[model samples]
Target: MVDDRDLLKVVSGIIGEERTSDDCCMIKVGDDNIILSTDMLHESTDFPRGMTDWQIGWMSAAVTLSDVASCGAVPLALLLAAGLDEPERISGITAGAKDCCERFGAELAGGDIDFHSELTIVTTGIGRVEDEYYKTRRGAKPGDIVCVTGTPGCAGAALEGSERYWKNLVEPLPAVREGRLLAVAGVSSMMDVSDGIALSLYDLSGSSCVGFEISMDNLPLSPGVSPEMALYSGGDFGLLFTCGRDILPVTGVDCTVIGVVTDSGEVLCDGVLVERRGYSHRWMEEI
Candidate 1:
């Protein structure tokens, strides 16, 4: 069976061009460059119980903008496509989208609308970057410290029926500021943990062709979150990065050193091989 990764490979092969697994695709325009990314949230798969329409709006924008920030791009605007029937719901979604843009300093330029059987929101983020400063998921080397921008696993906890963690799940704050700081700090490689940390580490390993030795004890966990949740939970939206030098102090962001890059292609958590157990599309179990 072809999984998501396999499907991407097949599509890339069909396109006949070298493509990246990076969250966003970048293009050079004149002296500078522009980055583009899109993300969609469906009510059936994404929306948790007891979430407000405002949070739904906010998260749709945040998820797409997270991709923009991961590439060290300054958000310019957002294009939204909302599918719904209720006018009130649409209003809340657009309002939340507007608020998200305001918070992140972007513009909700325009979007489309359609009525569908289920609610769906697709947002496209537009961002700009200096030609030399864009970030990617490659370039990690041996001796680099692997770090995460903020605590993780809250969303996982929420999925496991934690009411407190529900706030984290519905109203996620994208690490845009942290991503910008890491870009300026000259991070070797970085990505957001929208997927589980285990899958994320495997991705980084494959991209940079380097192994990682992560200390499970070093993972910065949210309160009431277990090791399994911290490792396999997705929707964290924290920035995970590697740098050859020590991390510089960033205001308002909690940076934690969790592991080190190695030449071997093994990803370990406290001397144990990290398993591929996470919020898979087929099964989002908290084991």
Candidate 2:
């Protein structure tokens, strides 16, 4: 018999070790602080077979950083859990991870490795945020404006076609400084567009019993990306936040008010219902 539940159990155990995603999961213990986020880049599942070792390594770090970034936590360090085919490949993976992490001002604190048939990189990041203006998904008001930074659906769109999606793999994540900027602006709430905007909105609206109203026409899609997919694509890695009804003044980062928070759980695209949510653990059978 196979133990399919083993991984789920272990993951639950690890997250349960502390607390998982609830009560906002934090501890004030001493000077060292912690914010836990995990991202797994499975070769077969996440990337196309022909992906370069460098892209694989870089993306492995970027995705995890997205979680930390959305939390408005200043990324301080990262640790890797890898399974490599050869000892030599470890150098490439480490170098790739180092280049990406350093680009974002985080350090390769430490990591562990084991041998495997295929390469697997799991990144765990730890960061700390000041008590003041620490962003959360919990504070959006009914009339708050829904704003997003940079373009939407770039990462996901880049993965779709020959010319565009591949090019974005190397495009540095627009995180770090921008997230801090939004927080200081006294934004009501924030989250990164890791999963499509739709799923992310629901995740952020958790327990608050608040829903979101999004204007699809206002969605900022990258030139190479399509609007049809932008509405529900994942991996964009842009910041989606809520503020007052009007767009806030910002520099360096492009901001747009694409929606408004509401008391109902239904999400609308210019007053119409949207289908085909975000990503799935299985093949993307579009809804």
Candidate 3:
């Protein structure tokens, strides 16, 4: 195992921040502060050998940006850490990263370049929100309503019936606006879905120590996506949350209530606990 401590030590040193913020970090500078997150994409690890360079750049931004969204923070700037076999490929990578940043009202702050045989992208994202709106993976309470932003299984729908990806899912609505919508509406403890519903929900459950119950029938589905796949697939890039039960106001993409929080340490849907553990990078194919 690479271990979280060593990884954090190296990342904190390289990024110039000696502190660890757990899932999300905050620094106070008088009245204003900032939140930071970094994600890495390696050609040998993330991309298949025959993947297209154009999609590589776009996918890089999408994956990294998802982390920022998961923190329930609005992105402000993005920095690229790139290594490439072909220098010309940097342009495409930048363009893609820039496109994603621009879509979410974020800036392409700066980047580093290195020469290598395989392409890799490392993104450092900066985001901010008022002190009152720093949503994280915690704070969920018992009886809170569990909702998911937008339709699920977007990438799954794109790869329907095919185990391996052939094309990227259609670019969905950026979660920035959705976060803004939820923040202003006074919702907290939100995260964007990346590791599939069951896994991500399990994370929220563990973080809050409150079990969850989701109604399989109410789980939102994208066109042509299966319920199981939609529920357990990643790249949905949507928000999944457990909010107070006052019918609180929310904005941006539509959300569907899948379940509620419970006292037990288990998740149930339609009278059954989720049998599969859901998707993880280490078990995508197996899931």
RMSD of each: 3.0, 4.3, 4.6
Question: Which residue pairs in model 3 clash with each other?
Answer: none
- The lDDT of each candidate is 0.85, 0.71, 0.71
Model 1: which residue pairs collide? Answer: none
What's model 2's TM-score?
0.86
Model 3, 7-99: lDDT tens digits are 655777777543442345767767865777777778875665555666677677766666666666788888998998899989877887788
Top TM-score hit: 1
The numbered model that scores best in lDDT is: 1
lDDT of model 2, residue 132: 70
Question: What shift in Å separates residue 88 of candidate 1 from its native position after superposition?
Answer: 3.5
Better of 1 and 3 by TM-score: 1
**For residues 85-115, could you state the per-residue lDDT of candidate 1 as single tens digits?**
5666988898998999889989999999999
TM-score for predicted model 3 compared with the true structure: 0.84
> Could you tell which candidate, 1 or 2, scores higher by TM-score?
1
Q: In model 3, what is the error at residue 72, expressed in angstroms?
A: 3.3
